[model samples]
Target: MKPKTPRISAVDLFCGVGGLTHGLVRSGVDVRAGIDLDPSCRYPYEANNSAVFVERDVNEVTPAEIKSYVGGRKGYSLLAGCAPCQPFSTYSQSGRSKKRGLDWQLVSKFGELVSQVQPDLVTMENVPQLQDHEVFEQFLGNLHGYSVSASVVECIKIGVPQSRKRLVVIASKLGALEIEAVGKKGNSVRTVRQEIADLPPIAAGEKHADDPLHAASSLSEVNMKRIRASKPGGTWRDWDPELLAACHRKTTGATYPSVYGRMEWDAPAPTITTQCFGYGNGRFGHPEQDRAISLREAAMLQTFPRDYKFLADDETVTFSRLGRLIGNAVPVRLGEVIGEILVEHVRKAEKGTLRPISEELSGRLF
Candidate 1:
């Protein structure tokens, strides 16, 4: 008989649009429930990930509930948590942050749950800046006996189409664990053309019936005029003298030229952010196309599948809502890489014999 398929189950905390959940499922892990307080996520989380969305706060969640949701058994029960990182994100320090609240305590809340549930595996992904946080240091210290591993790895090296770095950690009660990150090959990262080059042409705010999520958000009048003048890989500086934004003319705004720009057809995209649907956000404009990258393109740059559904049939395509979902997701591709490492960790867990790399993965390194 074919060797029994690996039995792994996962519970996703702060799961936005089920990107990671969907990836784990595709990799043969049985993803149970995607826990998040956002009720809006119910549609896409369940629609694409095939996992139930538990619309409850992660901090408020109890170990009994986690055990039940993960289906307590001999199989590996993976707890994946990506607490809201706006507080620790570089963007928070880059400018004045408009976001704050109890949600910032969630990373610690996750550590508390990990102490209680002691799942077979643990995974957390967030912006690379989080590695510098005192809370991150304390969280890693809390894993006393378990084999743990974490790194501030780049997403591009792992096949993500965008240039994004994330802090990924994996821990296990089993023995030691290790996950080797894919090294970046000569700067030729996957390009914008490789991602969505062949799709039929689409205008701003247009939707393609062939792909449910292949729709771009509409541009405002000013942005429309700007895009008309912009070239692929070109910046807002390319705009005609009359079309410059008042902010761009300001001395401070001149420092960031990547804003309000178009991606190059042969180049990788800038990081996809919550505002990626907006023409003025980052370099989200489609290469050769006169519009900001669509919700679908954003998701694709984040390494979600081409046909991944972002909404249920009854759900309306609201830019604010869908953009938030796609922007906030733990790129499924990242999760799959984590899953493969965790699966290997579990396989060696019984003997408590962690691969050397696993040991290196267990220690902390900035």
Candidate 2:
């Protein structure tokens, strides 16, 4: 009889709302657990993914604890971390020197754990700006024993219905590493209309009675008037001068035209930020509706499944809390691509026909 293929298992650090876990599972990796500092994540992370949620800060995680969670599994073990990227984000760059502190240190901690535990595989995703930081360089330097490949991926090219950019790194102690791209532009790019056009519409400041999470934040009277005048792909520049905010009236703010704009139905959405439910944040206004995208719509754009449960039936949907969880999640489709990359690498290694790192790293392997 032929021997069985050994299972690959993973532990997700800073796993917000189980986005990475969900995608990895869909790609056939057994995600054993998730670790995060937020107590709020426990419910959705565990409920949706069927994985244990350890409510602890990544800085406080010990290598021994990680080993125990893997339960002495004999196959490849994976460690994935999507460290908070706000410290390295473009919005924070202007004040980074003053704000640089513990969060920046977390990446170094991830490096330290990898050096100590030497998991079979390690993967991470963060803002593309992180590639330019010294900390990222140090993390790459620390992976001397592994084959590593890192790239700035356009999320839209990976089946996500948003034009978000992220830096994805895949490292393996086993063999050569490569992450294949997913959706291709012009041919397979998903659009806002494709993802959420079928959902029942709700008016500004209203919730869908059937799906509580499909609720939009209440808009102020002035903001309702502002959205009424807004056009898809159009900016506040098109609005009546009287409706423009005092900030937009200034030359400096005029340069920020994407704010308070509506997303085009056929195009991908702007990046979903932690405050996406507010009409004033980014191009969050609905293409046709007079309110910002609902919490469910924002999650779907992040590549979460349409029926993914985030809250209990009795719980009131809190826009601020859910927005942070959805905005901060690693897009599930991106995670699935990462999983497929690792799985293919493992299969090639087992066959004793692994490709050379230099050749594989030169071009798009996907």
Candidate 3:
């Protein structure tokens, strides 16, 4: 008898714009459905992978719904849950009042779904800060019978073009299983200027009507003037004496200089933020162009393929939403690395040669 081929199946939770879903699909996994609360995700999620997207909050998702999507499919059932991690980010830790502390409950809530679905495999991608949360530890403890692995990983080491760090966890219910070590860093890191320099130039706070995704956000006249005066890798100090904000002149202002600078064309872009399209936000200004990175450029730095379509309409989408979607995503390249890791594990399992990580990363990204 011929040996069986692995039938891949996955369900993405908190699927913001389907970045993970797209990567899994690229690696030959059949993504059953993407579950999230935003109705806006439905179009892109469905359009890109043809996977149905549930516009329901994860708190309300039931096992029956998951079962219906799986439908007795005889393949690996991967429940990849990437709960929102803004509450655990370092940015949240320093300012904005700790009143919005990490919501530790989401992990346990996700655990409830895992207990119900009892998938062959489970994975989660989140901010590195989450690794220290008690709630995160509890979520790992809940996986009693499975081999669990969690690590604070550098996304660039995994081939993501940007510098983003995430905590990744992989667990298997069938038996002890762990993700393989990431290989040594790839040849040359992809830089911010290299990725988006080819696009047609657009001015600050302007939109490119041709390709909706290529549109640059319109800056306020004041901010636009600031961007024009901004130097690559230089901050507010570069501004003319009169142009300097009152905040910058204050005693507490020196520390915020990374906020309003342009990216260096030869280096990787600054980590994308929810406000990346704004020139005054996070060194997001273009190197030579007097504008922040465009929507397409932001997504590209997230490692989404250039042609990855986010919409099916001619109507324009706002930069705020675009920034949120791109910034929140696990780089699709990083997702592919996870998918490839899963693929290798599956392959090894078939050959009876699989091995588990020994207490996660000890040194290096590998």
Candidate 4:
């Protein structure tokens, strides 16, 4: 009989609520553990994934600690980091990031860990804006012996129901590795109508009898009037002068028209943000409902399983905390795509059939 193939193992860094870990498991990789600093994430990450949740800052995590998670039995070792993107996000360009004390060197720390651990495979996902920074180039410099492929990927093209653009980088010591192309030709883009159209409808401030996450935030009397007059896919520009906010009346605020709008039923949702639960935050209002999209709908748009657990039996469900967790999660489908590519890369390497990316292009960021 042919010998059994050795198992593939992985450790997820900055794994918020196990979005990436769950998707990697779904694609057949054994993710041993997920590490994040937020204690609130512990219940959801461990409850939803087979992996253990480690609450520690990534800067303090040593190579030995990462290896200990998987023990002695592993054919391939993957170190995956979807570092918090707020530091490199386009939203930060307005100078508010300075006040948040955001750590810009975390990506460099991730690279330093990779150099120390020297895992067989490494993958990273972040906002597309990260691709332009010198830190990303320095991260690439750390992988001295790996063939690397990096690109900006559209989440909807990979079956995610939101219009999120993320930078994905794959590196391998075994041989060349490229993210597998998916959602071509016959595969239709996932739409908002397909994801949340069937849910039991609830009005503003109402929670479903059985599901707490289905609750919507309460709208004020004036905001209720504004929403009632809002049309799907239409911005605050479509509203009457009486319904417009004082800020919207100013020349500066006129540029920010995407807010106070409703999502279209037939199209994919705009990128989910931490403030997505608030109707005034973005075009987050429900297509037909007279309220903003519920927490459950946001998670579904992020490609999480409809029944995925986010809290324990005794935990209280708060919109602010849950919204941040759900919004910050890596879309699960994109994680699955990375897993598929990694699995195939290993398979080809074992057969000595893996192709190497050209040296000229390997160092270039797409």
lDDT by residue for model 3 (1-366), tens: 844446768889899898998887776677899998888777777877779989997878888888888758877788886888767666545543443343455667788888778887788888887777787777877676666767777766666667787888877654445333456435467787668778888876566777778878777778878988888888989889888888899989998998879988887787877788877668888899877888888999888888888877864677777778778877887777677667656766667665444333333234
In model 2, how large is the Cα lDDT of residue 83? 89
lDDT of 1 at 264: 88
lDDT of 1 by residue, 53-117 (tens): 89998878999999997755757888887888877654445432555345447888888888888
TM-score versus the correct structure, for each prediction:
0.90, 0.93, 0.90, 0.93
Model 3 residue 66 CA deviation in Å: 1.3
Evaluation by TM-score, superior candidate among 1 and 2 = 2
Candidate 1 regions with alpha-carbon error over 4 angstroms: 1-4, 90-101, 179-188, 350-366
Pick out the ten consecutive residues of candidate 1 with the lowest summed lDDT: 179-188
Q: What lDDT does model 1 reach?
A: 0.78
- Go through the candidates in order and give each one's C-alpha lDDT: 0.78, 0.85, 0.76, 0.85
TM-score, model 1 to reference:
0.90
Regions more than 4 Å wrong, model 4 = 1-6, 92-102, 178-186, 356-366
Per-residue lDDT of candidate 2, residues 1-366 (tens digit) = 743334788899999899998998887788999999999898889888968999998889999998887748878999997988878776545666666667778888888888877888999888888888899998888788788878788878778889888898888887666444332223378999999999999998899988888999998998999999999999998988889999997889968998888999999999888889988988999999889999999999988898888998777888989999998999998888788777767877787777665445544423
Instruction: Return the clash pairs for model 2, or none.
Output: none
Off by over 4 Å in 3: 1-5, 90-103, 174-181, 184-187, 355-365
